[model samples]
Target: MTTELRNTEFHIRARDGAGAEEHGPYELDIDPGRTADGDAAPRYASLRHASLRILRLPPGGSHTFATGDSEWIVLPLNGGCTVAVGGDSDTPFELSGRKDVFSGVTDFAYVPRDAEVRISSAAGGRFALTGARCSRRLPARHGPASGVPVELRGTGNCSRQVNNFGAAGVFACDKLIAVEVLTPGGNWSSYPPHKHDECRPGEESELEEIYYFEIAPAHGSAGLGYQRVTPSGASSRTGRGTDVLAEVRSGDAVLIPDGWHGPSIAAPGHTMYYLNVMAGPGEERAWLICDHPDHGWIRDTWPDQPVDPRLPLYEAPDADLRPSLNETVEAGPRPSLYEAPDADPRRSPNEAVEASPRPPLHDAPDARPEAHPEDPEGDAR
Candidate 1:
């Protein structure tokens, strides 16, 4: 690693895939010009747990790997592909990838630990190889895009879309946990500043996360956004604290080792998408977090507001893209809208729910409504 690469912390800026300088063990761009052999050596390969790789292949191009101790998911960022495992012995599965992250949810294939696999695209594609060191050798399987749950979170400007494709409760994985978040132009996601860096048994889990971003711009223009991670005032057992504030562009990545990270903002006129890959030393693959007390009040204000109108960007086939009656009903005179646990510090974490009793039809105008009861922020991390 060059001196410059070594000095930069947390946020990993994009680099020419073919650059001669070695990228430190935190970022890698799999461009054809740079790594003609195959996927570049993962920058985080030496980190005891999580690893990520971006793969780009031309039509007819293929990449193969031996899964050693890490299980991986083949998530297409763009285009379709085929996943073949165990050579002729096992059947190969196909994934119908979307045109882009913003296009819609895409099917993904999971490759088990200690296996041999090959991934190839028919027309050409880019993929995110999200991997984590694990002990269980789970079966390789394909997840359909239609099955991925699409969640609309926050209200108005804080609203965003979350595709819970690989959430802990949604999909079974040994240690790898991954999800995608889409913030419309001028919106904010990952609000209330939360952290999962401590292993507090039933309270929180210690997890390291990577935020890989992609910004969508208007036609003939560029896109930009910002991300912030403030110190949570609690240091890791190693006595290190993470702090980062970055201007992120497409392909940029941010590493969250410890902190209250949030308020990922999409600049006006440009939508932002980010793939979150996480894992930790804990035995249970849970994504528990603690909201920053200072900003936790933001959740209470959501029930009084309406969700952004441009949600569910691309519904699965046979799904309705139109706004549901539930959303409209929640925005009305009823008080059923605010029931999120984070909205009230008095509410126990275990009290969070998907649906709760509808509040009285009428309440005082000063009533402080809680966030949506559906828990849109639950699996987003």
Candidate 2:
């Protein structure tokens, strides 16, 4: 990889069929008050190297989850949860939710392959939980799952999560990490210069990253954001130094190959929400972002700012981050190149519900590909 490609970069948003091969700029909305075992089966996918299955649970529901041979991270996007990593263990980890908190659930609980887990949601709301394996592909190392006799819901794993990734299991390259970074309403993240290459002194772990944002739902007309990424002076892709100041809404995405990034510029009228996923071939999972050397130590001279009180972990996660009405933004629009029209399980399969040969969340931008225009066989959700 070139020096510039080591810092930050973006992949084209996942088109309809794009998710089948890769994951980027994708969105799946959940129906409120729905549970996993509901009428339609919740979605599940074992990507080339990882398996991520999500289910919505109603209040007072219990489910068993297995991590077979993979390390997993279980997060309840909404609602309060009781999770026991190694079920049957005497001590279980508990997370409470505030009335104003997201769907009322605490953040994710890291679960390693060393244990089996069970979860319960007390408050009724939609819950999105994903389980992905670790390490590169090898054999069928199935983690424990939502096993039998649990309830009227299907005890068996779905047909979709049963494909063989063969040589592409979890470890192909580092996959994901959960970071609780505090970027006050109007601050930035990767400022002051830093990089994560060369396992020497400061910069350990050499991994690629993905930034997923979750803004305060209530930032009505003013909640806008943007990112700036470009090549550093010493290493430019071309003789010219080009930089991009890309503005973003809730679901937009940007690519970063090099340069200094920051000042997530949350427009004057609102705050912002964002999550970043990083994975690469390095052993260390810790983060060490390098800034423009000239501006590197700016962090030492910066003052800490307080966060907005009305965001997630505080109040209810607003339904959808609607489009801004009549506001002007400094950054340009960053729309996804593709979209998954039938993302919700509650919706009946329309023309956009076919299967693909690529990974689960990375495919084309239109409808799911069909076998042939002349054939219309088994096409269930």
Candidate 3:
């Protein structure tokens, strides 16, 4: 790759975990303000299509935003809120405060750019409501994932989900493998100091990765964290391993244009979550990453560990909850109404898990590690 393709930066933070615990009841204070973990004005043009706004509501108080040609995901960062989409006077979705909440577990809600969507809450809590000009695509297939959903247990690392976009219904603007992960307290995520700019055996992703962090200080205030990434090849021994070391926090995004990344170290007392967005220019549209030669051996040691205990589930924490969304949505029966939103009217954008099931690319692909125990720290060697 050309050096020009190496565009990257780690916008430093104003202070370490300054607003780790939010406080306020402002309309649009937008407190994060460019801090590493702090929310700030987005630099991407697409952001215009999507506006991420943080609202601080007074206890028992509420707020609303009339909609435009846009959809939104209302996420409560610290406090809880009740989002009344479409002015549902009867059963608007109610989200619990720092408690196990159901009903509002959607990745996001689809609101047309034409209608108005509203939000409300109690006790003036803090919440994040992100807006996006979404072009609704066909929902991905549900049911059992075709390929085995592996349970990776790396040293000091936690559990994670990896989905190659090649599966039908899975969106693919480029070669991107969407991976979600939950890093436990005292654990890490992307480790082993591996590189993937080049394709390799058992690993075939040739795309760049973007890590979007979501931290939960559910138990304490503030934390220490860092992601060690370096350039592979001759650069390691010559000290040119890399010039990048990102100290991230919630809301922070890091772009891995190329190189080896590892040891996503959690601070002394905090938990973390991340969504990995990958994309490349290959026709196969797969995740073909190659590990640094010195570190490929680590994958063999995963069977001894377990997944981080923070992943989401639809069924009774172990059962499939897809059918509970609604019995009459007619996921497979009607291909026109609930199937095509634009062809018809945008039905309830919530509970779309039953739309379609993605096909497994390979019949019997790789044998993924089972639910594993958290790996030990300093095991990334």
Candidate 4:
């Protein structure tokens, strides 16, 4: 690979985790200016069909925009909001968004091409606008958090959590396909090494993928993980390929132009989370892939192994409550949303909400010797 390609293939991108002002193709940090106009101007023009922008709105703040030739999803990274489509004739769809991406499944709204949208939050929130240029215009709609299908895949150390909210066949859209994955500490996800960059008749479809990462913090310190993408070795019409092995942290991202990506590994004590945004030049909106032949045998071994016990990390809103620090023993009704760190309502644009360290959902059996028995600080290795 050329030096330019090699250097850009897979790498960690750092920004003010509190919303930096930097702008580039690989990642777009939250920009306050765009939030006022409902504009998230992503920099990767080469992505061709798709773009992503994160919108941060203060409490009682609102933003409006028109979807000219692209379809989009108002995916909440934190807090809840009301998404109003059309003018004033229809009832706005309400999204009871979660506290943070790793907390649980969140409600989302879909805005079709050529439509007008207005998003307003009673208590302020941050939203991810995942967009794709499209030829077909689908209807404006809302997807309830309760309707998201949470799937647990792989087993043993390869286990992971998948929130198939915008998955193909599960949700309708013109050309956008998205999903969220959570891999627990010491586990590996996106495994069996797969590739969807080839457009085969029925086996595979070429798609450009963006992975937005968020690593769970440990000991009031930073968290870490790893990601790998290898060249497929097959020539393509675009003739693009890459080989990448990178150490990733919260707010980092990896762009896959053409390669076999896999083994998104979480560090021994920090869970890993990634939001996948995908779109392609294919005629149909489908997620098709061919597992790397060398590692395809891994799937056959899944049935023999048991899934990790700490799975199904977060469930549908209506499901029975899972054990959490926020839950109460004598409660009549559990708090439905995770609590975000306190934020001043009148803060300036440069200011960001304080990010509180997320306490572990359950205790791990493989904790280190130095780990505190009660006030656990993780492995710290």
Candidate 5:
């Protein structure tokens, strides 16, 4: 059953359904343009910054599109492809993608705005075009899988693997921030309910987020998971709030305009994966979130508990395997968007936490750094 809430609507739950089509194998497409078509269109138009499209290609298939005013990343969900960008004399980027989301991390390509882009695959596969409207036209580049920082977040059942491939400081982008999360069956990620719907200096940044999910199959049957988004009260700037509670499966996507979202629960026996795409109106490209007061205490307990043994699903690539940025793509030197005063790109999330002085668990919520100590530098979501 495919469902969508329309106009000024804050929460949108898009379930995968037969007959839901969007040019070729684009299972779902959410952009600022979709919201202008009134009730007939998907009610995600209120989203001004972030956009997402899921494309599935058969063996030996290809697709082409214009970037317009947004920068985009061609990320392979499964399989590999060649990304050709218009106006560039450089050779097209060759993404040696993985077998599936459950496999190892995959490489990606970033294309600047106002350019023509073509993606072709000799052997068909699925890809996610994650995008965000922006002003600067950064150079097109390739992101190697080995450079992606993999972090294990939370403890016990909350344990999950975070692949910070397009994370703010990890990759250079004008307004987009994207990452992949993998949760073992029966565990909960995105826990303790959090929100980034307001700009509160160092506390939170008002970013719109999209959650696209894919559940691993159990034997011959499909698997499922649950997503929750509740209102964060009325806001003077955006008016009302947002709300949603849905069972999500493969090809499912949930849009969050303004609300507290959490506990993305995976059913037993079925591992879950979700790609998070985020962007906002803020000039500073950082991800700062405020946890719900009711659940904020959960962070305190993590220090005492042991992380689930199943964590660190996979390790980061060895240093020797990492390729030089100049050899991979033709990109200019750009400062990191989410750099902290003392951030070290070379350190892992866990290593950073160990190196820094531990803050008291009872510290005032607003006093915490822009990002959780356990997350990549400058990222709290």
Candidate 6:
């Protein structure tokens, strides 16, 4: 299901489970510069700063395109690839990517705007081309996997791991900000509902964000997750507010133009992963946000609780101080607060509990205490 509400701000692109049709090599392609005719307002006006495209290549397949006015990062979701920008004399960058998103942090290649680029994967793989329209054209470069900062955020059921690879201060870019997040099965991340929709100087920056999700399969069945976005009494330049509640599966994507989005919930027995791509019109390329007043108090409870034991699923390539991907750490039964009812799996979690009262936060058992580092860029998602 592709929801392009030209009259509104929010949109969703759900993956087709029935294999009814194909969307070619690019599973999802969102270019704000491209617009449909006769629209009351450009469906992607708020997305003018950021763009995302998911490409799946076959064995020995290659793809080429011009960057135009956007700087992009060729990030492999699985397998490996070579990125080349400019003439044939230029040396192409070889990226030793990982087996999958859950495997470990993978290296990436950055290509500046107004250049021709080519990506070839000898063994085939899936790649995420996260971009942001920018005026400055920086030189193409490679980002080593060992350099990505892995941060453990929140505690208890809110525990999650964040891979700040293309973060504003972490990496150099004209306007792009990208990151990867991993949440253990049955836990919640992106909590304390936050928003970066308004330009309030030191408080918040009006950045549009794109969430690309991949749910780790449980047993032989496909897994699912849930995402929620509610209006924050603020409108985009086009005068449209955002609102969304969707059942997100692997290959699905959610576009948030302006709103309070959070609590990306992972279903039981399934690990959840999301790639966050963001960029805005702010003169200072920074990620600053304001937490929703109603749920902001939840962050206070994290200090007393322990982080989920299953986090840091895997460490960076150079780090041997933490557990590897193959090592299984026992995580006891999930807290009763997250237990799902006997309802349709396709329904959003919020919808499943719409008639009931909110569950109280319970301390997770069998977890170890880990320090929650303060993010210099406001709240850590």
TM-score (all chains, Cα) for each model: 0.77, 0.46, 0.49, 0.74, 0.83, 0.79
Highest TM-score model number:
5
Q: Which stretches of candidate 5 lie over 4 Å from their true place?
A: 1-21, 34-42, 234-237, 319-333, 336-381
Candidate 5, residues 52-149, lDDT tens digits: the string is 99877888998899998899999999999999998787639899998898877888998999999999999999899999989988778878776676
Clash counts per candidate, in order, are: 2, 54, 36, 1, 2, 0
Q: Report the lDDT tens digits of candidate 1 across residue range 1-381.
A: 332333255666675342435532223532112134544234432144666777777898888877777889889999999998884344387888989998878888888888888888889888888888789776677676655766666776888887877776555677988889999999888987899887987778888788889999797677988898876766444555666788888888877777888889999889999998888889877778888888888777766676676775765444323322224324443333112123434442223222446232122123225322222236224
Model 2: residues >4 Å from true position, as ranges?
Answer: 1-70, 84-94, 98-108, 114-122, 126-177, 217-219, 231-246, 251-260, 303-381
Candidate with the larger lDDT of 1 and 2: 1
Candidate closer to the true structure by lDDT (higher is better), 4 or 5: 5
Q: Which 10 consecutive positions of candidate 3 have the poorest summed lDDT?
A: 335-344
Candidate 6 segments exceeding 4 Å error? 1-11, 14-24, 35-46, 88-90, 236-238, 319-377
> How would you encode candidate 2's per-residue C-alpha lDDT over 179-227 as one tens digit per residue?
2222335545444334442344343334333344444445345355666
* Candidate 2 accuracy as lDDT: 0.35
TM-score winner, 2 or 5: 5
Shift in Å, residue 354, candidate 4: 41
Rank the models by TM-score, top first.
Answer: 5, 6, 1, 4, 3, 2
Off by over 4 Å in 3: 1-42, 45-55, 65-71, 87-91, 97-115, 128-133, 137-180, 192-221, 228-243, 249-262, 274-294, 304-381
TM-score of candidate 4 against the unseen true structure = 0.74
lDDT at 246 for candidate 2?
Answer: 61
TM-score of model 1 (CA atoms): 0.77
Question: On residues 1-381, what C-alpha lDDT tens digit does candidate 6 reach at each position?
Answer: 223343123444553321326445777776677535733236455566788888889999999989988999999999999999976343388889999999999988888899999999999999999999899876677777766767667777888888877876556677888999999999988897988887887668889899989999989978999888877867545455676787888988878888888889999999999999999888877787888889988766766676676877887666223222211111322111111112223222223223347331221122123211112434447
Compare candidates 1 and 2 on TM-score and give the better one.
Answer: 1
